[model samples]
Target chain A: MIEQDWIWGLVGGLMIGSAAALYLLVNGRIMGASGIIGGLVDRSGWEGGTERAAFLAGLVLVPMLVVPLYETVETHITSNLAVVIVAGLLVGVGTRLANGCTSGHGVCGISRLSLRGIVATVFYLLGGALVMALARHVLGVI
Target chain B: MLRLLSALVAGGLFGAGLLVSGMVDTTKVQGWLDVFGDWNPTLAFVLGGAIVPMAIAWRVAERRKVAVLGGPLPLMTEGEARPGRNLIIGSTVFGAGWALAGLCPGPALASLTFGGTGGIVFVVAMAAGMLAAPPIRARLDRMQPA
Candidate 1:
C-alpha cells in the first residue's frame, strides 16, 4: 500500500512539476501558490493580477471538476479549532515574510538550487519536525 | 489572453496534480511528517518527482530570454538569490503552522471543495496572514542596515 502511495505521489509530483514548468516556460511565472495569491493581496504585482486570477480560478475550479470522478479527498486536520486558526495565521504570515512557500521555495527554489530556497526548506523542515515533536508528544494539543 | 489561458491551464494542471498525487490528503502529509510515528516516505517521492522535471525546465529556461507568450521568464538575477533572515524566520513559522494544520496553500486551496469548514477557515486566515505581512516586512526592512 505504501509503495502504491509512493507511485501515485511520484506521478502526481511529475504532474506538478510539469504544470510549474509550463507556467515558467509559457507564462514566465514561478507558479508559487502563496506568492501568486500574496502578490494579489499585497497589491505588489498588480500588473499581473489578471493572470494570477486566471491561474487561481483554474486551480480552484479544476479540482472540483476532477474530485467527483474519484474517491473523496480526505484530510486529517487537527480537531482543535484554535490550532487550526493559529496554524493558518502562522502559515499565512510565514510564507509571505519568507517570500515563498513549498511551491516557490521547496519546489521551484530547490530545483534551481537557489541558496534562499535551500535554506528556507531546511529551516521549515526543522521547524516542522520540532513543532510536531512538541505538539503531538509533549503538549498533546494538536 | 493567451497568457491568461496558459495560466489557467497551468493552475488547473497543478490542482489536478495535487489531487492525483495524494497531496490533498492531510493524513498523508501528516503521516509523512510524523517522523516519530508511522512515518510515510510518500512525500519524498513526490518531491523527487517534482524536482527532476523542474530541474530540466530550469535548464531549458536558461536559454530563453522570453516566455512562450513573450513575457519575461522569472529567472533570478544574481542579486535576487541571496539568502537572508526573512527566509529563515519566515519558513520556520510557516513550517510550524504546516505541521499543526497539515496543509499548505496549494493543498489548502485544492482541498476547498471537500475540506469543509476547516479548509475555509484555513484559507481565510491564511489570507489575513498574507495581508498582515507587508507591515511586518516593512519593519524588518527598516531594521536592516543600508
Candidate 2:
C-alpha cells in the first residue's frame, strides 16, 4: 500500500502544492479554497459578486466533469446526506472563524510565510488528526 | 480588476484538470492511498494531466514576460525565515498535526466539498483549532519586539 500510495501521495501533494506554487508564482495570490469561497459568499465582504460567482461555479463543475472519465467510482460511506450538509455548514463556520480555510491557511498562507497562516494551519492539522484518531482509534467507529 | 479575472481564469483551468484527472474523487483519493491492499496507479494519470499543462504554462508565461493577471511578474517568493525558538516549536507542532490528519487545507476543502465524513470532521476540528489561536497570538505579539 505504501509503495503504490507513495506516488499517489506525491501526485496529490504535487497536484495541490504545484497548483499553489504556480498560482502564487504567476498571480502573487494564494489559491486558498476557503478564501475564494468566502469571497463568493454574501455581499458583505470585499469580493464582488461576479468574480465570486465565477469562482464558486468553477468549483462546482470541476468534479462533475470527471464523472464521465472514471466509469466505476465507488463510495463506501452512505450513512446520511444530512451529515454531509451539516459538515459543510460546520466547515463554513470554521473557515470564517479561522479567517481562512485549509487552502488559504494550509497551502497558500504557509507558502507566503504568513505567521497567522502557519498558526491556522497548525490548528487545522492538529484538529483533524485528533478527530481522526478519536473516530478511528478511540471510538472504533467510522 | 484584471488580477481577480486572471485568478478566475487560472483557477478554472486548474479545476478542469482536477475533474479530468479524477483527483476530485475522495474514494479515488483513498483508493490510491490504499496501495498495500489493491494498488492503483490511476493517480499517475492525474499527475500527468497536471504536469503537462503546467509545463506549457511555464513556457508560455516565460515567453510572455507578463502575468496573464495584472501586476509585476512575481520574482521572489522566499517564505519566512525567523531566527527564534517560537518558530521551530510552532513548525514541529504543525507537522505533527499534518501527519495525523491526511487532509491538509486544500484537500480538506476538496474533501468536504465532496461530502466525506472524515473530511467534514477534519474541517470542523481544524476550524476549532484555528479559532483558538487569535487570543494566543495577541498575547504573544505583545511580548515580541517590534
Candidate 3:
C-alpha cells in the first residue's frame, strides 16, 4: 500500500493546492483548515461565520460523496483511548496557540514564503519526529 | 451567496484531495514520520504537490487588489510575518499530536464520516482542546512575558 501510493499523494496534493488556489482567488481566504474551525469553535472569527460554516460543511460532507469511489478508507488511528485524547488535546491547543496548522503554516504559509510559516513548519516537523521516536521507539506506545 | 458557494467548492476539493492523497490514513502519516522504522515518503509528494498551485496562486494574488469575486485578498500583517515563541512552541506541540495519532486537522475532519468512533472521539477532544487554548495562551504569555 505504501509503495504504490506516492502517485496518489501527488495527485491529491495537486487537488489540495488547486483548492487553496481557488479559495484564495475567489474567496480571498487562506484555506487553513484549523483556523477556519478555530474561528467557529472559539467565536473569534464569528464575523465570517457563515462563510466558514459553509466551507466546513463542504469539508465534512463532500468527502462522503467520494468514499464510494475507493475500496477502503482506513485511518489506522490508535486504539488506546488515552493516546487519542491526549493527542487530540495537543493538536487542538497547539494549532490554536500557533495560529495555524499544516494547511495554514505548511501549505499556505510556505507557498508564500512567510517566515513565520516556514519557522512553524520546521518546528512542528521536528517536534513530531522527536515525539514519534520517543513514543514508538523508546516508550513503546502509540 | 457566491462567496459561500466558492468556499464550499474549495472545501470540497480540499476534502477530496485529502481522501485521494491517502492523507486520511494514519499508518501512512506515521510511516512518513517513522524515520527509525520503515519510512514512507509519500507525504513529501503530497506537500510538494500542494505547494505548486498555491505558489502560483500567490503570484497571481500579488497583482490583484481583491479576489476575483470582490473580497479583499489576504495581506500578511506585521505580526504574522514575524516568528515568535508561541509559533515555535505551539507548532511543536501540534506536531507531537499529529505524529502520535497520525492525524492533523484536515485529515481528521475529512475522515470523520468513515473514521469510526475513534475519529469522533478525537474530533471532540480536539475541539475541547481548542476551547481550552485561549486560557492556556494567556497563561503562557504571562509566564514568558513575550
lDDT of each: 0.87, 0.48, 0.91
Off by over 4 Å in 2: A25-28, A72-78, B1-5, B16-68, B72-146
The residue-by-residue lDDT of candidate 1 on A1-142, one tens digit each, is 8879999999999999999999999888897999998888879879879999999988999998888887755666666778889999999999999999989998998998888888999998888888988888889887
Question: For every model in order, what is the iRMS?
Answer: 1.1, 6.9, 0.9
lDDT of 1 at A66: 82
Better of 1 and 2 by TM-score: 1
lDDT tens digits by residue: candidate 3, A44-125: 9999899999888888988877886778767888889899999999999999999999999999999988998999999988
lDDT of 2 by residue, B1-146 (tens): 66455555555555544443445554454344433334356654554433443444444544555654554443223344432434333333433333333333344444344545655665565555454444444665688732
Deviation (Å) of A1 in candidate 2: 4.9
- The model with the greatest lDDT is 3
Candidate 1, residue A57: CA error in Å?
Answer: 1.0
Clashing pairs in 2: A1-B35, A1-B36, A32-A103, A32-A104, A102-B105
Clashes of 2: 5
Q: What is the interface RMSD of candidate 1, in Å?
A: 1.1
